[model samples]
Target: MSARLVLHGVCVGLLFAALAGAPTPAKAQKIYIETDLEGASGVYKFSQTREKDTPPNIEACEFLMGDIAAVVRGLRAGGAKEIIVSDGHGSQAFLPRLMEPGAKYVTGKPRPSSGLDETCDAIVMVGCHAMMGTPDGVLCHTQSSKSENRYWYNGVETGEIGQSAIVASYYGVPPILVTGDEATCRETKKFFGEHCVTVAVKRGLAREAAELYPFEETRKALFEGAKRAMAELPNCKPYQVKLPIQAKKEWYELDAKGVKGKLMTREGEILDLRDLYKF
Candidate 1:
């Protein structure tokens, strides 16, 4: 429901010294960051994400905000001209007071898009999790963890990371950075390639269990990763999937009693990548 665009300036005179030799100064980069809650630092349980407004969930939102702050500061330090952060979590976890000043924050519900466009130089995924069925992915699930949803595009199983990148690709934006758990990092590498920078804050032991890293250490690493992502931007490419995509989604159907019943399947063709989540 609410979207705000805040602009901040960076020291381009020194930041782009590498291009100083050129006749004209290069334009500063604009980056869009998408975030989720399940993979946030210090959050590895469903109780922290599935429920909203609870003490555990509120604390988890703060943890996610801390991680975003680090990345936003790092992106600014890395010479980003403008930055936009979106709340990609299902329940929309965003604490405006705790937000970093360098970027605009997008939260609430029923938004038209992720606020990404062709003008964006790169996209970043923060606090993202692996797809369903990842044995070592802490709190991992696709679109709906409760329904046990799973998706396949062109016969290849894809997770939130890949799905987001695919949508970014529609706008010619490359995914340059991702931060989450070890399994999530692996998933990013598998889809976005090693050229994409990934920072893992924990090592997952199971869907609800993980070896969480200290917040201080993880924040430092996320900051460094954002810097590295700027440098890695050239090497990263937008993820492309052949279309019209043969899409298939499998999920559990809840009965009248609100209990999961038989598994349901939907098969269709996605003509537009922007509508990937809708399918």
Candidate 2:
């Protein structure tokens, strides 16, 4: 795994006009954004990420950034004073050029009590996908396409959103906005409440095929969802899961001819996930 990492935070400067009339700039609403490649707007298959010979992944990158940028705009429009966008997928190397100027970028996966603390007001996930074996999951897999087959937190089947939300809740940060394919939206709502806003950018037709919404419409909705979610932050309650949380997973990827063999696509048994929360 990579070391702990994050870029400088975006400083919320006081507007001369607003400060002149108000007691102080409104309390900064710190928002953390996590992003991935699959389920991004306009992405139809894995080659956009897995195969280098296809169209320049830059196109896909732009699609990914469009949604993220929209969310930031929405957050700011809804009165957010500070924002942090975590390059939560791949090598944590994507999105440097597209990150909003008003937000910081965390470059690596964050663990409990690490760079992310109790200060964040809400968590947002972009371009997320459903868990492995999801019939309607688009490019579905857990944190890894190869290495792990299944993941369970307290015996409940989950993906990145569930795992992240659990860790974030320890710091009292509830997930408020999630943008992805429709199946993932179902999963997000199942884990977080329906109050946690969702913006589905695509619908999966098969593992490698998806029917995406109009790029512009997806972006607009994400922005509006963030604005609405921020306005009702009070209703986006943190998902409180029982501690001493037991987790379960099965390991089969290693048995494959390589990381890309059948085992990578096959489902494995459950394993305890509680150890990850010992922190």
RMSD of each: 10.6, 12.5
Per-residue alpha-carbon lDDT of model 2 for 95-200, expressed as tens digits? 5777767777666556442455588888888889888878888888877665646776666877877877877877788898888899999999898877999989
How many pairs in model 1 have backbone atoms within 3 A of each other, for residues 3 or more apart or on separate chains, i.e. clashes?
A: 0
Model 2 RMSD vs true structure: 12.5
Please give the TM-score that candidate 1 achieves against the real structure: 0.90
Best by TM-score: 1
The C-alpha stretches of model 1 lying farther than 4 A from their native spots are 1-28
Cand. 2 TM to true fold = 0.79
Candidate 1: tens digits of C-alpha lDDT, residues 159-260: 999999999999989999999999999999999898999999999999999999999999999999998898788788999999999999999998777689
Candidate 2 wrong stretches, greater than 4 Å? 1-28, 51-55, 108-114, 255-279
